[model samples]
Target: MKTIEIKGSFRKELGKKNSKLIRKEGYVPCVIYDKENNLHFQVHENSFQKLVYTPEAHLVKLLIDDQEINAILQDMQFHPVTDKIIHADFMKTYDHMPIVISIPVAITGDSVGVKAGGKLIVKRRHLKVKGLAEHLPENLTVDISELKINHSIKVGDLAYDNIELLDPKVTTVVSIASSRVALKTEGEEVAEEETTEEETAEDKDKEKKS
Candidate 1:
């Protein structure tokens, strides 16, 4: 995994008022926790955009008071209305310790079913995986080049080294279904509406004649 360096300073005071003041200054209050200790610090809010927005998972290299540590983003707080990040939590990473992380799923290759007028449906955009910090992948790729109509790729179909998928093996990840399925359902709905309109029109015509 790639790492980005973030600089921070220790927060001497901890309170709601102090945290609000920190945000007002364009900084976000953050906490770093590990098996050893938990530390309170603050970092510039804008500096976290790359880490939060990217699809690839990353290990953060936090530099605090001349000390450096490798960590992963564990959680965050956001503004209720604007949805802007207000705070973040960093968890220390150790080489042998197992960690759970969600990795984006990337589909590769052309689907044979789509070429035959089928539609590709992706059910899961990401997969939860558990493994050692070093073994976790940045993203998982699924190949649909040979997918045929009515065929699906399930979680059990995936194979990776040193990592375990946390999702149920039977859960569907992607599938190629006939396009007619959607059109048939829509046609049924439209036919029902048309039948109702005809019935109403016939009733109105009889009432007028009476």
Candidate 2:
């Protein structure tokens, strides 16, 4: 996973008044939690844009005082009306310890069904996975080359090295479904349409030319 460094200062006092003061100074109140203890700190609000306002998962390198810690953003709180970040939480991570985090799903390849006029639909953009930090990938890649109309790629069908998917097996990640312009179908039982001799020859020719 990608990493981002944030510089913060340990909070001297802990209370609503102090937290409000921190926010007024353009800083966000934050905490880092681990097995042993919880450390309170404050990070400048500007330092959170790339980390909080992104779709990618990241390992946060926190620099507080003379201490440096590796952690992940666990939770965040936003102001009710302003929608500004009010508080943030981080969970300490270890290279050898297993942790669960959500990873973005990246789609690769054009679906055969889509080329055949079916509509491609993405159901889940991210998948929950568990593995060591070193084993986690920036994103989970799902190939849709052979996906057929009316068929879906579910959580159970995906596999990644050193990581386990935490979503339900039946949850659909992506699917090729029939659309107004899709080829005519006889029934739902036929997930994929049989290719005609002419179409097969055309495909072979296209492959040869490529």
Candidate 3:
């Protein structure tokens, strides 16, 4: 994956009051954690724009105080009213260990289905995958050059070197359906939506508890 450098300073205190103070100063309170310690820090809110706003995954070269760390963005909190990022959580990583993250999916080429008057619908924009940090790419690129009407590119159809897809094999990532010839696909999609929706709800619940 691509790497970007971010500079921050160690947070001297930790509390709701201190956090508010940090935000008032235009910095976002942040933390990096693992099984051991949680290191508190703050980085300029603007500094996170590229990392948080983009769809692609990126690794961070964190410069906090005088120490350097390599990490991946693990989670973030957004202001409910403004929809702005207020805080972030990162996880320190090593070269040899595996990390699970959601990577953006990039579809290339015009679908044959589209060319044949069928509408192509993207059901999933990203895929969750597990692999060593070095093995992960910036994004998972899928070529839809040969996708015909009513055809789909599911999680099971994808293959990558050194990467294990974490999503269910039957999950449709992208598909060319809903055309006159494929109207029946809509019924099948409803079932798939229910499955995906349940997974999303579970993830939200876990995030809230965390």
Clashes of each: 0, 0, 0
> Candidates' lDDT values, in order?
0.90, 0.92, 0.90
In what order do the candidates fall by TM-score, top score first?
3, 2, 1
TM-score (C-alpha, index-matched) for candidate 2: 0.83
Please report, as a residue range, the 10-residue window in candidate 3 with the lowest summed lDDT.
178-187
RMSD, every candidate, angstroms: 11.0, 8.2, 17.4
List, residue by residue over 79-186, the lDDT tens digit for candidate 1: 999887899999988877888778889899999878767799999999998888778778899999999988999999999999999999999999989788655755
Task: Compare the candidates by lDDT and give the number of the best one.
Answer: 2
Candidate 2 lDDT, 64-95, residue by residue in tens: 99999999998899999999999999999998
List candidate 2 segments past 4 Å from native: 183-210
lDDT of 3 by residue, 32-59 (tens): 9977888999999999988988878999
Model 2 score (lDDT): 0.92
TM agreement with the true structure for every prediction? 0.80, 0.83, 0.83
Q: Which ten-residue region of model 2 has the weakest summed lDDT?
A: 185-194
